[model samples]
Target: MTKTYEESSQTGDFLEALRLAVERARTEHSPTDGMIDWRVAAIRGQRGGIAGLNLITVVIEVKQV
Candidate 1:
């Protein structure tokens, strides 16, 4: 199975939310040496069930370099 960094944003727009997510991820997870790069294998937003009407899930992943 492919493994990726997953995060959630509270924005209706995917692109806008992604920008913020990436920045946060980089700062939090990026190495101090700066030898690693995160490649987005997939970024998706899914709708939740009836309970979470406006719940948005953001899934981010690093693909094979």
Candidate 2:
């Protein structure tokens, strides 16, 4: 199986973390969604999924404040 690729952050800025993740997805030419596991990640907990792509299936998660 192909390994999942993700970008996660814990900078304490929720929007910034989401922004960076979305930017990473587009730059990497991939949709983020389940590509990340934030809790065990560089950040922790689920703030919810922020949609970046046309399909609702694609999402970017942010760290909770």
Candidate 3:
């Protein structure tokens, strides 16, 4: 599973943050069955501005076979 977020900053810091989090989770064996089959989790940003940002958080629950 994966979660994503976006911000209006000129630098790609948020992307990097999400990538690092996923990588850490994968390495730490937090994902079900030790593998990532799809994006089962997500936190998306719907709005952004110079002062702040608004986001819609999505949570995906997975079941292992």
Best candidate (score: lDDT):
1
Lowest summed lDDT across 10 adjacent residues in model 1 is found at 56-65
Which scores greater on TM-score, model 2 or model 3? 2
lDDT scores of the candidates, listed in order:
0.55, 0.42, 0.45
Per-prediction backbone clash count: 0, 0, 0
Q: Estimate each model's TM-score.
A: 0.45, 0.35, 0.32
Per-residue lDDT of candidate 1, residues 1-65 (tens digit): 33355555665566665666566666666656643355555555556666554434455554333
All candidates in order of lDDT, best leading = 1, 3, 2
Instruction: Give per-residue CA lDDT, model 3, range 1-65, as digits (tens).
Output: 33432223233345554555445545544555587433435555455688555544333333333
Task: Let me know the TM-score candidate 3 reaches against the reference structure.
Answer: 0.32
Say which prediction, candidate 2 or candidate 3, comes out ahead on lDDT: 3
Q: Which pairs in model 2 have colliding backbones? A: none
* Candidate 1 TM-score over all chains jointly: 0.45
Candidate 1 Cα outliers beyond 4 Å, as residue runs: 1-3, 33-36, 46-56, 63-65
